[model samples]
Target: MSWKKTSITIVMGNDKYPKGTRTATFNNIVPDPTEKQIKSFAEGLQLLSDGDTYLGSEVIKHDQLSAE
Candidate 1:
């Protein structure tokens, strides 16, 4: 399967809503995804752990994302 590249902004200041709401931007994709695909992809990624996901964050800005 061909996978597209995406960058998501995860605000994990705390595990509560309004504070932990995340934003994802899927760019350079061959074709735009459907609503189901979008939801599925985000949910799948959200299931990752700190050990499984190499996330980077700026302590000052509180912006979190997968480093690589």
Candidate 2:
């Protein structure tokens, strides 16, 4: 079976303004992900998937944030 892995970001939003709620974002890598990276990511998700889904994060430099 072939599965595609994806990356997503979870963000906390302001509760005071119900309409101002912020949603998590998902950013897809460009130039195509390597086969090794794809396999590893899929495996990680599978290991964590026990009837439920989970999200992971890796901190990057503030300047590295993409405006796109």
Candidate 3:
């Protein structure tokens, strides 16, 4: 089996919505990426997406299996 369709969700929160959160989802990521890599990517994405209240991130991956 292998990992496929990997994605990362960047979560953010702001003073206006202290208990609320927002997220940005990026798909088609390289499988098994490092934390540092995700962080850097998220930071850059945040800048471009105008997300100033970065909280954290989550990585999601789908398992791919061969029938043969």
Candidate 4:
């Protein structure tokens, strides 16, 4: 398997969590994340998790050659 670089955004929500810290993974990737990506590409990543719910996901960074 090859390595793919992507800036995914994961927004979590629950009654116990507040709006300030609701966002699990903001915009940008782990290496160097900028602000937040309001328009996510994917969601529902934490269906198996507990109270943490996946609001959305966005792949800002990716390899164009991976398509081939």
Quick one: best TM-score, which candidate? 3
lDDT of each: 0.41, 0.42, 0.80, 0.50
Instruction: Give one clash count per candidate, in the order shown.
Output: 0, 0, 0, 3
Q: Per-residue lDDT for 12-66 in model 2, tens only?
A: 3344436643334445543345556644654565465443233333322222434
Clashing pairs in 1: none
lDDT of model 4, residue 6: 58
Identify the candidate with maximal lDDT. 3
RMSD of each: 12.7, 12.5, 2.4, 9.4
Question: Estimated TM-score per prediction?
Answer: 0.36, 0.32, 0.73, 0.40
Name the candidate, 2 or 4, with the larger TM-score value.
4
* Model 2 pairs whose backbones collide: none
Rank order by TM-score, top first?
A: 3, 4, 1, 2
| Cα lDDT, model 4, residue 25 | 46
Location of the lowest summed lDDT over 10 successive residues in candidate 1? 54-63
Q: Per-residue alpha-carbon lDDT of model 1 for 1-68, expressed as tens digits?
A: 33335333433222444644443344443344455654555456657633223232211112236556
Error of 2 at 33 (Å): 0.8
Clashes of 1: 0
User: Sorted on lDDT, highest at the top, how do the candidates line up?
Assistant: 3, 4, 2, 1
Please provide, for model 4 over 1-26, each residue's C-alpha lDDT reduced to its tens digit, 9 standing for 90 to 100.
34356555566666676563365444
lDDT of 4: 0.50
Q: For candidate 3, report its TM-score.
A: 0.73
User: lDDT of model 2 at residue 34?
Assistant: 56
